[model samples]
Target: MNRIEQLLPEEIEKRSFEIISEELDHMGVILPEDEAMITKRVIHTSADFEYTKTLTFSKDAVAIAKELIVNGADIVTDTNMAFSGINKKALSRFGGEVHCYMADETVAKLAKERGCTRATVSMEMASEIEKPVIFAIGNAPTALIQLYNMMQTKQWKPAFVIGVPVGFVNVEAAKELIMETELPYIVNRGRKGGSNIAAAICNALIYELTRNHQ
Candidate 1:
């Protein structure tokens, strides 16, 4: 079987529901009764994908970066919070020239200390990177738009885009932006995905893409 077909369907459904429930709770309100009726609709829309993967924490992020490196990814962008628990050492140990980007200064310093060659929040820096940008923005569509605009203006084409936005706002919008590109991409289905989960999805995408290529 292809790797995608081998994924456990039941486990995927369980994980998707858990993620959606957690995100809705975190949003501080349940959907209106009308919207609630559409719950199956949402799930059905997302589940059309043939592959699904779940990620928990830092180790997942490290594993993803390693997989991307093995697949010949040249640049990796870490767009999560500064101290979001991703293992920098694992990314460093993968032994490729990986570029890291974060929104916070302390996180950039930490990534640098862990052997990331370049770190910055500037979209201009992203333009200069020579490899595909593995972008992980935690459910912030505005931020994703900014990045997209930057790339569009510069006419820079990344090898692929892995977008993981896990939050209440613009999750779907961000996913749409990534999807519109028609590039190889990965994303979580709904809200409640924080930076950690988003990173995990990226990791899973890397694993899938690398395995497929091999």
Candidate 2:
């Protein structure tokens, strides 16, 4: 077995990023600046380099997301885990907040009455919010489908979307549907994302914004 090297508590993350960058370089995987930042963060979170290929971005998606974040865009997530994982304090600096309506009693009741998943109702509730919204979906394809449906009817428009739901059922289809739109989005092309990834992507963007502000 290889001996573990001594590392200070704070050095771990910095060293991890250094390793991620070196590996990406060794693989000849060069991403554009902002996209690279997001990609590296995703890879760091999952320790999966496959994200270099599986991650997709709409044109200027990262830039647009940054702009929205600077303007105080609120984020709506499909899962509480994702909601909890985001850097709330960092986002709050820009007057933004993270929301996960999946646990709301009203959402649950409405979903049962309408025979839809809580994700669907949660999205519906999110559409009613007046602020600029960014969606980070990591667990449910239904939420993406519902958002697409709402977009079709002109009932809702998100400033940006991170559509990375992980599953075999309808996950790929939902991601494809979102890609068909002109909306800005960061998505994983396959069933290879999770709530952790979604939160990581959000934090990545927020961290970038923090750097720009500083």
The C-alpha RMSD of each candidate to the native structure, in angstroms, is 12.7, 1.1
Residue lDDT tens for model 2, 65-123:
99999999999999999999999999999999999999999999999999999999999
Reference-based TM-score, model 2: 0.98
Scored against the true structure, residue 195 in model 2 reaches a CA lDDT of 99
Residue 67, model 1, lDDT: 55
C-alpha lDDT of all candidate models, in order: 0.48, 0.95
The C-alpha TM-scores of every prediction are 0.48, 0.98
Once fitted onto the true fold, the runs of candidate 1 whose alpha carbons sit more than 4 angstroms away are 1-68, 71-75, 78-84, 97-100, 103-121, 202-214
Q: After aligning candidate 2 to the native by TM-score, how far in Å is the CA of 15 from where it should be?
A: 0.5
The prediction achieving the highest TM-score against the true structure is 2
